[model samples]
Target: MSANIEKLQQVISSYFGTSEPIDESTVAADIDGWDSLAHASLMIRVEEEFDVQFPMEAIWKLKNVGEMASLIAKLREGA
Candidate 1:
C-alpha cells in the first residue's frame, strides 16, 4: 500500500476502534462505529493529520476509503 493509504488506514482504525485491516473498498457503511458522529470526528482527524481542509461538498461525496485517499492526494498536490 502507498504511504497515504497506510496512514489513512491507521487513522480509520484508530477512529473506528477496529484492528481489522481496511482496504480501498472499505466504505463507511462497512464499519460498526462509522456513525454520523464518528464520521465527523474522522473527518476532523483526517484534516488534522493531513493538514488539509476538505470542502463541504467533497466531504459529503466521499463514499469509500479509496476516494478519501484520492481526495487527500489531490489536496496535497494542490498545496
Candidate 2:
C-alpha cells in the first residue's frame, strides 16, 4: 500500500476504534456506528489528517474509502 493509503487506514481505524482491515471496497455499512453523522465527522478528520480541505460538492461524492484516498492523494499532489 502507498504511504497515503496506510496512513488513511490508520486514521480511519483510529476513528472507529477498530483493528478491522479497511480496504478500497470498505463502505459505511462495513463498520459499526458509521451513520450519517459519523460520516461527516470522519470526513473532517480526513481533511485534517491530510491538511487538505474537501470541496463541499466533492464531499458528498465520496462513495467509498478508495475515492477518499484518491482525492487525498490528488490534493497532496496538487499541493
Candidate 3:
C-alpha cells in the first residue's frame, strides 16, 4: 500500500512537474495547475502506470491523491 502511494505520488509529481505536496486530501480545485488538459494527462499517466482503464465518471470524480490511490486500488482489483 505504501509503495502504491509512492508510485502514485511520483506519477502526480511527474505530471505536475514538481512534488508540490499532495495527499488524498489534495483536491483538483486546490491544486494551482490542475486544469482539464492536465487532468486528462493525469488520467493517461495513471492508466499507463496502473495497467487499468478508468471510466469517464471515475476520472471526473477523482478529487485528490488519496482518492486517486483508492481508485487505482479498485481498478487493480478488477483487473
Which candidate comes out best when scored by TM-score?
1
* Model 3 agreement with the true structure over 8-35: per-residue lDDT tens digits: 8788877778668766677776666888
Question: Per model, how many backbone clashes are there?
Answer: 0, 0, 1
- TM-scores of all candidate predictions against the true structure: 0.93, 0.91, 0.84
Model 1: how large is the Cα RMSD against the reference? 0.9
Candidates' RMSD to native: 0.9, 1.0, 1.6
Q: Sort by lDDT, best first.
A: 1, 2, 3
Best by lDDT: 1
Clashing pairs in 3: 24-66
Q: Who is ahead in lDDT, 1 or 2?
A: 1
Q: For candidate 1, which ten residues in a row score worst on lDDT?
A: 29-38
Q: What tens-digit string does per-residue lDDT give for candidate 2 at 44-75?
A: 99899899998889988888888889999898
lDDT of 2 at 54: 86
TM-score: model 2 vs. ground truth? 0.91
Cα distance off (Å), candidate 1, residue 30: 1.5
